[model samples]
Target: MKYDWILFDADETLFHFDALKGMQLMFERKGVNFTEQDFHQYQQVNKPLWVDYQNGNITAEELKHIRFIGWAEKLGTTTAELNTAFLEAMADICTLLPGAKELMDALNGKAKLGIITNGFTELQAIRLERTGMTHYFDQVVISEEVGVAKPDAGIFLHAMERMGNPSKERVLMVGDNPHSDILGGLNFGIETCWLNVHQHERPEGINAHYEVQSLHELRSILLA
Candidate 1:
């Protein structure tokens, strides 16, 4: 079947976190003063909190404040200080995944392209704009912006609606997370592609219509 739109996940799919890590280390060298342990703890606390937010157990403001507060407590820093430092550091970092620009350029007018991400809208926007990848998307749907996260059919439907409600069979959702993007697409009755760059095994009960190791594979899949 020919697809009319291709929706992508941002964090791991289009933007690589390795770039963020490098920037974080640069911040550490500049005396922002976070140790490896501190960073790991921060991530440990942050990830689950976002999952809770995605699952509708917490509000966006609450998630943001609480994530920083939790990190501050673990690192013995004040919430205000952590907030300032975190956002500054994140904005300074956050680079796009390798070949992201080329792949997007290749698909520019081939079909409709959109972004459906479970990230903070402001930060995601900053990252995309900084990487020069924002203009490639016809629609950018962030969970924070819509007040609904992935794995819920609502976010996917919202993106589809933004794309003018194309037939479900003719929409492709590609993302790195199995539980969020893959499962969410399945729930929305759209074809889903699992971007498994890390060589991870597909999670149980989350079947993707296609699996690709990199964005380059996308062109072939869409044209196939």
Candidate 2:
């Protein structure tokens, strides 16, 4: 293997992250019809909050409760209740991306696998457990618990500590987000692979050591 440790981003890289569907399912359980408009409205608040969270302008707890505040008021519930329900709904629908399992199965026993995600802790555990993907990872680092999100050296440093401080050259970070995943790893002095499945344009001032449109392509590249 080319690398001793392979780190992956959870949402949209290895796992399918369909927030719209998850939100609909969450509201349905509460006997509320969550429409397209409702989801858009939710995103108006949620998206900016994420940017703020990643930029270190807001804490995870603030982002969690603030995004669901309006919905909670309408549903006669607390933001905590709504947030937990949404996570549970997301877990119920958790699924690996195409060829994700094949990649993981192939990599197992060949190299160490780890997940470093900005995704919440509750959703991470349940999703991995529900999808039967728990055992594939040697490390699961959540930004919520680590007190720092990606693009911050602290979180990467934390992951490196848990990884037994492997040589940076022998570790690879694979993720869908160019800013948080690729750039972050690059800044931390490690090789990175951008998983651009949607064929998105490469962002400015950022470059990955490798780029692949699918996990299958990644598997081929890594095992070559």
Candidate 3:
């Protein structure tokens, strides 16, 4: 079926976020004297904060501060220092996934494209703009901005509304996360595409309309 609008997820879908590795390297380079265990612990603290933020239980600012505060409490560091380091490291390593630009270019003008991500609006926008992907999207609906994350259906609804409410059958949702992107799109009655970057098994009972192992595969599918 032909789709009029294509919605994409950002982090794992469009960009490769080596969050743990990057944080470890950045701390070492900055003389923070943190161990890999510390980085892992920090990530453990940060992930749930993002989930909470996506669930609308916390503001973006609260999530940001909480991550650093939790890490600092664990590592005996100041929150201010941890926050600065985390932000700097995140900004430095936020690179696009391979073939992301090409796929976006390939889809350009062929179908309306937009971003529906469960991330901080400011950070998500900065990542897209910095990676030269800002212009490719017709709209970017961040969960933080919308007060709801994917799998909840509200976020997808927000994206659909922004896309002029294209027929559900003629809309495609693409992302890496099965829980968020795939399940969310299915819940919204839109076709879902799983960008399975890691070759993850398709979860039982939650099938994607399309499956791509890479961005190049996405381009090929669009061309087909």
Candidate 4:
């Protein structure tokens, strides 16, 4: 590998984070049939909270509790319980994205690996463990633990610090989100690769050092 350190974003970049499906599974366990309509309603509240969360306008705990307020009230359950259940449901359905394992296996020992994620702390460890990916990473930086989310320079600094403060040019950040992962890494002075699996157009202001449609493509490029 060209870079001494390779950092990844946890959610869609490495794992499948199907929130709607996870919500449905969560509601199924609670005996509430969660429809697409309910998910849409959920997103109306959830999406803006994520924006606020990403902008650091709200804390992780606040984001966790606020988004489920209506559903908690409707179910007569605590938001804490609802949130924990949701995380559990999400964990139950978690799987590595295609080429994820292949990339990891190939990249092992080629460069130090780490994860910088905006995902909740509760899910990160468990999912890594369950996916048998725990041994592959040297550092796992959670925005929930760092008190700042991506698109903010603070979280990246924390990650780089944990990475033993490598040369900025010797690092590469890979993620699916153009704004958070690509832009954040750029601001932090590291190279970035966007995993544009959906083939969306890159945002006007954001530019990554590399863009690949699949992890296999990334692996081929890295090992070429």
Clashes of 2: 0
> Candidate 3, residues 1-224: lDDT per residue as tens digits?
27788888988898777777667766777666777787777778888887776566887667767777765776687776776666567767899889989988888888889988876554676777678888999999987678777777888878888888878888888999998889888988888899987787778998998998998988888778
Which lDDT values do the candidates have, in the order given?
0.79, 0.95, 0.80, 0.95
Superposition error at 71 for model 4 (Å)? 0.8
Q: Give the runs in model 2 whose Cα sits over 4 Å from its true position.
A: none
Q: Per-residue CA lDDT of candidate 1, range 54-162, in tens?
A: 7889977777788677646766877656555656567677777777888888777877889998876656777878888878889999887888899888888788778
lDDT of 2 by residue, 149-216 (tens): 99898999999999999999999999999999999999999999999999999999899999999999
Clashes of each: 0, 0, 0, 0
Predict model 1's lDDT versus the native. 0.79
**TM-score of each model, paired residue for residue:** 0.88, 0.99, 0.87, 0.99
Report the alpha-carbon TM-score of model 1 versus the true structure.
Answer: 0.88
Candidate 1, residue 46: Cα displacement in angstroms equals 1.7
Instruction: Identify the runs in model 1 with alpha carbons over 4 angstroms from their true place.
Output: 18-30, 70-81
Among residues 3 or more apart in sequence or in different chains, the pairs in candidate 4 whose N, CA or C atoms overlap within 3 Å are: none
10 residues in a row with least lDDT, candidate 1: 18-27
Look at candidate 1 and tell me the lDDT of residue 190: 90
